[model samples]
Target: MTNTQHEPRLFADEAAIRRVGEGLIARTLPREDWTHEAHLAACAWIVRMRPDIAPERDLPAIIAAYNEAVGGVNDDAQGYHETITQCFIRAVRLHLARAGQADLPTLVNGLLAAPEGQRDWPLGFYSRALLFSVAARRGWVEPDLAPLPTVMEA
Candidate 1:
């Protein structure tokens, strides 16, 4: 679940989103700046601008490398999480499709305003215990609660 201790950070424009994405790609974003909102921002930027890199196929390595660069570990307990990353990527893709031709910042803001952008969104699909399990963290675990929806359901 998202750490609700802090308020969600909103991007002022596309440049803010691009900064998060490019920083993530370059492994240069400050670790503390990689908040949950920042994750969605980066995903939105990638989905909108870097079509050449399929997020589902390529983000795992990128995230893992970034974690290492930021002095974090990609172990079962922390760093890259396969299930969470994949789920958000799917959600971001759906948001992008729904937001055709919109500016990148608007697309991202719309996504952040959606229910799927909530940190606890996956909880609607997977049980808390299962979603937080090491197995789920290391690999994709089929949702144990309600099924994840297709883009058509968005």
Candidate 2:
């Protein structure tokens, strides 16, 4: 992966990372559908970033669940955000439960535990950073975490 001088720090702290995972779950639970690549990529990102949250062995089942949930749509454009978020959330929850953490549901549900309309800027920002970092690490795409477009020269 190419190093950037200004790479965004997504997992700056343990609580912050957990919050992002919870936010992902909160965004995913209500959705009825998902996408395969998006799910796989997201799960992979979470696992890569926080192996303790999700063991590598659980990836196959997580991917399978996402595939089954989507019903074989295979379209890249279908519910990108929801699917990705769900995959990360599911992976973490599955890992916690499988590892006997005893607080899986609480951690998963904590995202919505926050009051309505409360802005989770760090979670939102870091989620995107994690996605870009994972994509670049896996060579799936170029990493572009820039918040704004570059100014063009005449």
Give lDDT tens digits, candidate 1, residues 22-141.
999999999999998899999888877998888998899999999999999999799999999999988888888777889988888887877778788788889989999999999999
lDDT of each: 0.87, 0.36
lDDT of 1 at 143: 98
| Candidate 2 positional error at 60, Å | 6.2
Clashes of 1: 0
Per-residue lDDT over 38-77 for candidate 2, one digit per residue giving the tens place of the 0 to 100 score: 2322443365355665533444344445444545332333
In terms of TM-score, which candidate is strongest? Answer: 1
Candidate 2: TM-score?
0.28
**RMSD in angstroms between candidate 1 and the native structure over all alpha carbons:** 1.9
Clashes of each: 0, 0
